[model samples]
Target: MSLRTRFTEELKAAMRAGDSARVSTLRMITAKLKDTDIAARKAPTDPGVSEEQIVAMLRAMAKSRAESVALYRQGNREELAAKEEAEIAVIESFLPQQLDEAAMAAAIDAAVAETGAASIKDMGKVMAALKAKHAAVLDMAKAGPMVKARLGG
Candidate 1:
């Protein structure tokens, strides 16, 4: 099922089951999706966001939570950090299955080879290739340096 369909059903289940925390988290996701859909309408695409865009939104939400978790931990707020971690788990539910380390390395290798990326200047080509095929699977921030290293950039 699409992420939206599953999320709608899950929201209903959470409500019926009195899962307050889960319900709140799901509501946050739906709200974020609504905002994304509205933003996409202003662009050259469809009236609403696509599944791909939704995945990107989810990744952004997850990244934000990760940063919050780090901040909470640094502030010695374990309880708050745990909450952020839980929210991250909720946000991650909508993402495509992530690429394992081996899979990511292999895919990066292929993209480097395919683009004949010999130097750092070709980083854009490698990034574009990876984004096209693996946007929802790979963590681009972490992958950037790896790709650069492979290209001797």
Candidate 2:
């Protein structure tokens, strides 16, 4: 099934299970997706959001929460950090398996080879290639620097 369909069903299940935290997180995701969809439809004629786009949105949200959690922890707000972590767990349920170090390395290598990226000037080509194939599973924020490093920038 599609990601949105799965999310709707999971939301219903969470409601039935009285999982307030999970339900809240799911609702937040759906709301963001709906907002994004509406924004896209303001100009386009399509449904305005693809599954991969939604996955990217979720990954961004999760990553933001992760950063906030770290900051909160550093500030000694352990309770708030734990809550953010819980939200992250709920958000991650819909994401595909993330690439690890080895997989990320291989992906960077392949993208560089495919684009024949010889210098920092070709970084965009390498990044675009990797994004097209692995945007949903790989953390580009982390992999971007790695790609630049490989390109000797």
Report every candidate's CA lDDT. 0.88, 0.92
Q: In candidate 2, what residue range of length 10 has the lowest lDDT sum?
A: 39-48
* TM-score of model number 1: 0.91
Residue 134, model 2, lDDT? 88
| TM-score, cand. 2 | 0.89
Clashing pairs in 1: none
Model 2 per-residue lDDT tens digits across residues 1-153: 998998899999999999999999999999999998997785666766998889889988999999999999899999999999999998888899989999999999999999999999999999999989988888888998999899999
Residues 1-153, candidate 1: write the lDDT tens digits: 988888899999999999988899999999888878877687666658778888888888989999999999999999999988988998887787888878988999999999998889999999999999888889888789889888887
Per TM-score, the best of the predicted structures is 1
lDDT value, residue 2 of candidate 2: 92
Q: lDDT score, residue 87, model 1?
A: 86
lDDT of model number 1: 0.88
